[model samples]
Target: MLVIGLTGDVGGGKSSVALLWEKEGAHIVDADKIVRELWREPEIIEAAVTRWGSVILDSDGSVRPQVIARLAFSDVREYRWLCDLIHPKVMRRMERAVFASNRWVVAEIPLLFEVGVPWWVDFVVYVTAPPDERLARLSSARGWGEEELRGREAYLLPREEKIRSSHWVIENDGTPEELRAKAAELAEMFSFFSEPIEVTVSCGSEEEARRLSKAVIDRRKAACVHVYPIESLYWWKGNVEEDHEWEVSFKTVLPLYPDLVGIISKEHSYEVPVINMASVVKANRDALLWLWEELSGEPDNHAHRS
Candidate 1:
């Protein structure tokens, strides 16, 4: 089965791209939709009422997301606590879909890497939109105050990190047509079955971050996708504190790292945002190489790599 994970920051228009893929006839397993189902579970409501108290629940004993979103986003630990409660449930649902997919399947996994479930997918695709665009989009939609906006932003993995680790970057900053064009390219390529490569990609552009990721995976060079935020730390001339700018980490393969790095650097955002690299410390045998080859556009045999 061709299981692909899709992720993007808030307001990145990932759903828009997913629709384009749907038009092309891929089955979609939506993570957010599954999580929404969990929201209706009595256990979930009980947990919320216990933590945030009974007021968050409606008169009928249902959880009101807006209430929870406000309370949860107000604190990182609380938000994480909520994620801990819901993520596993979401995973179980995703697992069911993955097993059931007889043909190409697209799973809308907002936290694929964070939850560490991308390991099951043949590929991962991250949607990309500029941070300003994201902020603007959110603002226009909700008419939020600074505090509300910041709270929402705090819930997301840094965009820079998600973009850096992706295998395919669907730029959502453009018109729907532009995004659809990118999605089509991905659908065309994933039809291959030569196995994948494992490689780390330090990419600047969301497009490049994923392009290299898919390329390396398709090439069968490396396995496992590690994405983390790399903040540029600098001290103002006389300030004791250092300012943090963003960078991303991609852990893939030693052999294909150089080529991927070049492409990432060329496509990167910062004049010198680090396109960092690292080897996979541990991974499943065939799956590891399958990742790198799949991303690198040079699908190879997974058995030989092992």
Candidate 2:
């Protein structure tokens, strides 16, 4: 699965982008929501009460997050203490959510740069908008004035630094539809890596393996193919079969698996070739980009099979 660390400036529409990804079938792991749920735990509430007294609790004995936020944000030492207390627990839950998800996972962490991106995150996407736009959004949505917005933002890393550190940066000063379209496009690109597969086929000889590899690449059925010699042992014709064979591995996406299989079946010297496919759960981003680019074009139907 692909795990994206989604973060942005205050009121930059990071949640909007996450929601758009959710609509595209990506699972969302929201850090703020996790924090809210953690507040409901007796242990967490007890800890908060122990630190700040019962003043941090509501009349009903529930933790008041806004009260804690005001206290923590007012003093640097208090903020660090609060983060130290809550971040570990929040990270644990985030890890569990990401591990349990089979689909693409988008983790909306407002303070991702501040707390450090998790090692499990495949990439980071930073969202941003104009200062005026952001202020307008916060004011209208949360009734936060400029002074309050600036106070919260002062604790975060500089916008330029965050943008420089990110793998992708999204500018979100447009209409909601436009932001949704951008999210959709990004989701599609991420799906390419999440659904890529490595297909292995055993050929009768080195020459056949080479030929099949060329055929697959020439037709754009696979981004690339590697051929190497291997010893095979398997049951065939109700008897143990042993042979020296060549293995061909094709790097391609799941959507093109059938086309790759078709090329192998039509070109392999063996009547019943050994064909196996495995999902590529992780890969280098640059390599995946190259592979995706190679396979992005239409198939070369004019090329003859040889």
Candidate 3:
């Protein structure tokens, strides 16, 4: 599986790139969603309330993010304490997310490096812009002053470190159209070198599975397909039993996922089927590049994205 981690400074246009990836049919796991979900962990929220006092709470009794950000994002000790509380949990979720993203998964994590999670990624794209540009963008978007911007900037790892650590860099000081074009270009380039995929599929004694799996792989619905015998343990009709089954796995470029799903549903034997895709965990670089070429859908297929 190719795991690409995307990160950028505030107002650096990371979302634009993620959106572009989505346009070409890539799955995106966003860290912002993770953090929002984390706020619902009562113990963690209670601990924060106790540490920072209750003004951080809203009328709905949820911890207000702005209030929490004010406390934890500015004061180093407070920020470190919050990080100590949240970073580990976030990382754990990130691990699950990466694994869940079968094939090429693009994760939009804003503070990916600041939280020090780069090692988990196969490729990292650090989005950046000049501080002045960042401040200008943020001020226009959030009505923040220079001091506020500096405070936000200071808490993050320096820009230089972020850029130095990345395999690719996206500078966001240009217009949205420029950003979109650049992002499209980079995504195409990355896809050009991605490995051709392989997949494993599992199915209940449904007669259509073998044919379906083979057809999907044969037609490039997914890059590769594997069928295996599976012994499943579960409860049916309030009784548990072990049942023999066939599992088919598919390795395919991300773009073909929708079609893959359609085929599995249309052909699988089970009335209610299991058709979940898993991200590729690790793969040979040569295979990856080949996959990339097909995924990019370059005009000539022989031509490189660049």
Q: Please report the candidate that would top TM-score against the real structure.
A: 2
Error of 2 at 32 (Å): 1.3
Candidate 1, residues 1-306, lDDT tens digits: the string is 467788877778888878877787688899989988889988888888889898798898887878888888778899899989999889888888877765567888877777875566766678768877877877898666656656676677677776676666677777777777777767654433222223333343455555555554454434444444444444445676443332334444444556666655655554654444433323453554455355555555221110
In candidate 1, residue 34 scores what lDDT? 94
Local distance difference test scores for all models: 0.65, 0.84, 0.73
> Where is the poorest 10-residue window by lDDT in model 1?
192-201
Q: Kindly list the per-residue Cα lDDT of model 3 for residues 1-306, writing each as its tens digit.
A: 567789978878788789888886567888888888999889988898889888988988888888898888767999889889887888788788877764457888888887876555777887777778878878888888888877887888888777887767877778889778777776665653443334455666645557877767666675556677779997777899687888777767655777777877777666667677555547664566556554445543321112
Pairs of residues at least 3 apart in sequence or in different chains that clash in candidate 2: none
Who wins the lDDT comparison?
2
- The lowest-lDDT stretch of 10 consecutive residues in candidate 3 is 297-306
**Residue runs of model 3 more than 4 Å from their true location after superposition:** 192-195, 198-280, 284-306
Q: Provide C-alpha RMSD values for all models, in order.
A: 19.9, 5.4, 8.9
Estimated TM-score for each candidate: 0.61, 0.92, 0.66
Deviation from truth (RMSD, Å), model 1: 19.9
Ranking by TM-score: 2, 3, 1
Error of 3 at 239 (Å): 41
